[model samples]
Target chain A: MKLIGYFRSGASYRVRIALNVKGIKVEHAFRHLRKGEQKSDDYLKINPQGLVPSLLLDDGTVLTQSIAIMEWLDETHPQPPLLPKDPVNRAKVRAFALAVSCDIHPVQNLGPLNKLAAFGIDQANVTRWAKEVNFDGLQACEALIAAEKGPFCFGDTPTMADICLVPQLVNARRFGADISGFKRILEAEAACLKLPAFADAVPEKQPDAE
Target chain B: MKLIGYFRSGASYRVRIALNVKGIKVEHAFRHLRKGEQKSDDYLKINPQGLVPSLLLDDGTVLTQSIAIMEWLDETHPQPPLLPKDPVNRAKVRAFALAVSCDIHPVQNLGPLNKLAAFGIDQANVTRWAKEVNFDGLQACEALIAAEKGPFCFGDTPTMADICLVPQLVNARRFGADISGFKRILEAEAACLKLPAFADAVPEKQPDAE
Candidate 1:
C-alpha cells in the first residue's frame, strides 16, 4: 500500500494514526498542499476530489475520504479495533467523529478559508472564523463524552472517535481556539497522545513536515 | 425506531431515503429548523450536537449523524444493503458520499450561510456563497461518477452514494446551480427518483414540509 498526503492535513493525520494502530506498513508519498501540488494533473488523476490522504492498495485500488479509509482499515485489519463491535456503540463513535468531520472541519478547511478571503474578509477575520467554528463544535464533542469514564473517547483503549478527536484538537489549538473549557475532550486528547500511534502521527513528525 | 428531523434538511433527507431503501419502519417526527427547534434543550439532550436527524432505537439509544445512522441501519437490517459488500467498492461509495456529506453540504448548510450573514455578508452574497460551493463540489461529484454505468452511482442498485447524491442534487437545484453539464449525475438522480424508496423520501412529500 502507498499513502499520498500532506503533513499538516488533519484528515491525513487521522489515517496515519490508524495505520500505526493497525501496524500496517505502507510506502509514503507527499503532496505539498500549500504549493498547489494536490491540484496538479498527476494528483487529480489519483484523487479526483483533489484532497490529501488517498491510499493506494496493492491491488491498485485507490481509497479517498479519511473516515471511509479508517473504517476500511478497521474491517481489513481487525486487531486493535478502531471501533467497538456493538452497532449502537459504533454509531456513537461515528457520530463523534462526524461532529468534527462533517460539522466543524469542512467549514474551517483551507479551501473554504481561502474562499472567505476571496469574499473580501481579511486574514484576521478568517482566523477568527475558523476558531469560532472549532470552539462551537468541540464544545458539543465535549458534551458527548462528558459522562464516559475515558482514557480515550469511549473507554480505555483508543477507537476511531479518539483517532478523529486527536487530530481535530491539534487543529483547534493551532488556530488558537480557546478549548480550556472542554475538559473531557482535553482529557481524551491527553490520554490518546500518550500512545505512540497517535504521538508519531503528529504533523511535525510526518516525513513531509515543513 | 423513530427519526427526529426537519423535512428539508439534506442530512435528514439522506436518512429518510436510507430507511426507505432498507425497508425499516421508523416512526417520524419533525423539528422545524428555521424555527430554531433543533437547538431546544429537549432536542439538545437527545443529540448534543443539536442536529437533525437523530434516530431513536427501540432500546432507547439515540443515534446522530446521517451517515452513521445509515450504516447502523445497514448493519442491523442487512438485506437490501446500502453499501457494496467488497471493501474497495464500499470505500468508493463512501468516498463519493463523503464528498457531499463532508465537503459540500456542510458548507452550504443553513447554519453556515447564517454565519456568513452574521459576518455582514448580505443575503444575495450569502446565496452566492452557497451556490458557488455547491457548484464546485457537485462538479467534483460529477467527475467521480462520470465514467460509471449508472442507473445508480455504482451499478444498477442504489447504494449509499446514490442516497447522498439525490438529496444533494435536490439542494443544488434549489439553489439554482447549473447542473446541466453533470449528465451522469442527472441520469443517476432520475433513475433513483423512479424508485419508490427515493421518491417517497422527497422533502415535499414529508409531513413537516412547509
Candidate 2:
C-alpha cells in the first residue's frame, strides 16, 4: 500500500496513527497541500474529492476518506484493534471519532478557511473563525467523553476515538483554540502521545513536514 | 428505541432512511433546530454534542452521530446489510457516505452558517457560501461514484452511500445548488427516492416538518 498524505492534515494524521497501531508498513507519498497539489489532475484520479490520506492498495485499488480507510485497515488488520469488539462500544468509539472528523475538522479545514478569506473576511477574523470552531467543537467533544474513565478517550488503550482526538487537539492548539479547559481530552492526548504510534505520527515527524 | 431528530436535519434524515430501510420502528421525538431546542439542557443530557439523530436504545443507551448509529443499527440488525460483505467494497461504500456526511453537510450546517453571519458575512453571501459548498461537494460526489454501474451508488442494493447521498441532495437543492450537471448523482438520487425508505424519509413527510 502507498499512503498519500500531507504532514499537517488531521485526516492524514489519522491514517498514519492507525497504520502505526497496526504495525503495518506501507509506502508513503506526499501531496504538498499548501501548494494545492492535491487538487491536481493526477491526485484527483486517486481521490476525486482531492483530499489527502488516500491509500493506494497493492491491488491498485485506491481508498479515500480517512475514516473509511481506518475502518478498512481495522477490518483487514485486526491486531491491536482500533475499535472495541462490542456493538455499543464500537458506536461510542466511532461517535467520538466523528466528533472530531465530522464536527471539528471540516469547518476549520484549508478549503473552507481559504473560502472565508476569498469572501474578504480579513485574516484576523478568519483566524478567529478557525479558533472558535476548534474551541466550540472540542468543548462538545470534551463533554461527550466526560463520563468515561479514561487515560484514553474510552479506556486504558487507544481506540479510534483517541486516534482522532490526538490529531484534532494538535489542530486545536495550532489555531490557538485555548483547549486548556478540556481536561479529559488533554489527558487522553497525553496518554496517546506517550506511545510511539501516536508520538511518531505527529505532523512534525512525518516525511512531508516543512 | 426512540430517535430524537429534526425533520429537516440532514443527519437526522440519514438515520430515518436507514431505519426505514431496516424496517425498524422507533418512537419519534423532535428538537426544533431553528429554535435551538437541540441545545437545551435536557437534550444535551441525552447528547453532549447536542446534535440531532441520536438513537436512544431501550436500556437507556443513547447513541449519537448518525453514521455511528447507522453502523450500530446495521450491526445489531443485519438482514439487509447497509455495507457490503467485502472489506474493499465496504470501504468504497463508506467513502461515498463520508463524502456527503463529513465533507458536504457539515460545512453548510446551521452552526457554521450562523457563525459566518456573526462574522459579518451578509445573508446573501451566507447563502452563496452554502450554495458553493453544496455545488463543490456534490460535484466531487458525482465524480467519486462515476465508475460504478449504479442504479445505486454501488451495484444494485442501497448501501450506506445511497442513504447518505439522498439526504445531501435534498440539502443541496434546498441551498439552490444547481445539480443539473451531476448526471451520476442525479441518477443515483432518482433511484434512491423511488424506494419508500428514501421517499418516506423526506423532510416534508416527517411529522415535525413545520
Candidate 3:
C-alpha cells in the first residue's frame, strides 16, 4: 500500500497512527501541502479533493477521508482492533473520532484558515478562532468520555478515538489553548504517548516531518 | 426511538433520510436552530457538541454524529443496507460519503457561517467562500462518480454517498449556487427525489418543515 500524506495534517496523522497500530506496512508518499503539490495534476488524479492522506490499497483501490481510511484499515487489519467489538460501543468510538475529525479539524484546516485570511481577518482573530473552536470541539470530547470510567476513552486499550484525540490536542496546544481542562481527553492522549507505535507516528518523527 | 433534530440542518437531514430508508419509526423532537434551542440545557445533555440529530435508541443508547447513527442503524436493522456487502466495496462507498460529509459539509455548516460573521466577514464573502468550497467539493464527487457511471452516485440504488449529496445540494440551492455544472450530482439527487422515502424525508416535508 502507498499512503500519500502531509506531516502536519491532523487527518493524515490519524491515518498514520492507525496504520502503525495495525502493524500494516505501507510506502509513504509525502505531498507537501505548503509546497502546493496536492494541486498538481498528477496528485489530483489520485484524489480530486486535492487533500492529503490518500491511501492506495494493494488491489489498487484508493481511500480518501481520514476517518473513512482509518475505519477501512481497522476492518482489513483487525488486531488491536481500532473499534470495540460491540456495535453500540463501536459507534461511540466513531462518534468521538468524528467529533474531532469532522467537527473540529476541518474548520481549522489550512484551506479554511486561508479563507479567513482572504476575509481580511487579523492574525490575532484567526488564532483566536482556531483556539476557540479547537477547545470547544475538545471540550465536547472530554465530556463524552466522562461517561465510561476511562483511562482511555473506552477503557484500558487505545481505540480509534484515541487516534483522533492526540493529534487534535497537538493542534490545540500549537495555538496556546488550555487543554488541561479537558481531563479525560488529556488522560487518554497521555496514555497513547507511552506507546511506541503512537510515538513513532508523530509528525516530527516522520521521514518527511516538517 | 426519538430523534432530536432541527429541520434543514444537514446533519439532522442525514439522519432523517437514514431512518426513512431503514423503515425505522422515530418520534421527532425538533429543536429550532435559529432560535438557539440547540444550546439549551436539555439538548446539550443529549449532545454535548450542541449539534443537531441525536438519535435516542430503543435501548436508550443516545448516538451522536449522523454517520455513526446511520451505521448503527444499518447494523441493528439490516434490511436495506446503506453500505455495500463486501468490505472493500463498503470502504469505497464510505470513502465517497466521507469526502462529502467530513470534507465538504461541516466546514460550510450554519455554525461555521456564523463564525464568519463573528470574524466580521460580510455575508457576501461568506456566501462566496461557501460557493467556492462547495464547487470544488462537487467536482471531486463528480470526478469519482464519473467512473461509476451513476444515475445514483454509486449505481442504481442510493447509498450513504447519495444521502450526503442530497442535503449538500439543498445547501447549494439555499445559497443560490449555479449547480447546473454538476449535472451528474443534480441527476443523482433527482433520482433520490423519485423515491418515496427520500421525498418524504426532505426538510420541506418534515413535521417541523418551514
List of clashing residue pairs for candidate 2: none
lDDT of 1 by residue, A35-85 (tens): 989899988888888999899999888899999999899878889899999
Q: List the residue pairs that clash in candidate 1.
A: none
TM-score of 1: 0.99
> Deviation in angstroms for B144 in model 1?
1.3
The residue ranges of model 1 lying beyond 4 angstroms of the native Cα positions read none
lDDT of 1: 0.91
Query: Under CAPRI classification, how is model 2 graded?
Result: high
The list of candidate 3 runs beyond 4 A from truth reads none
2 or 3, which is superior by TM-score?
Answer: 2
Query: Worst lDDT window (10 residues) for model 3 chain A?
Result: A69-78
List, residue by residue over B105-130, the lDDT tens digit for candidate 2.
Answer: 99999999999999999999999999
Candidates' lDDT values, in order?
0.91, 0.93, 0.86
lDDT of 2 by residue, A86-187 (tens): 999999999999988998899999999999999989999999999999999999999989999999999999999999999898878888999988999999
Model 3 C-alpha lDDT per residue in residues A1-210, reported as the tens digit of each score: 999998888888988999989888899999999888988999889888899889998888888888888777777777879988898998999899889888899888888887788889988989899998898888889888887767888999999899998898889999878988877887888889999878988989888885
Interface RMSD of 1: 0.7
Each model's fraction of native contacts: 0.77, 0.92, 0.78
Candidate 2, residue B109: the lDDT equals 96
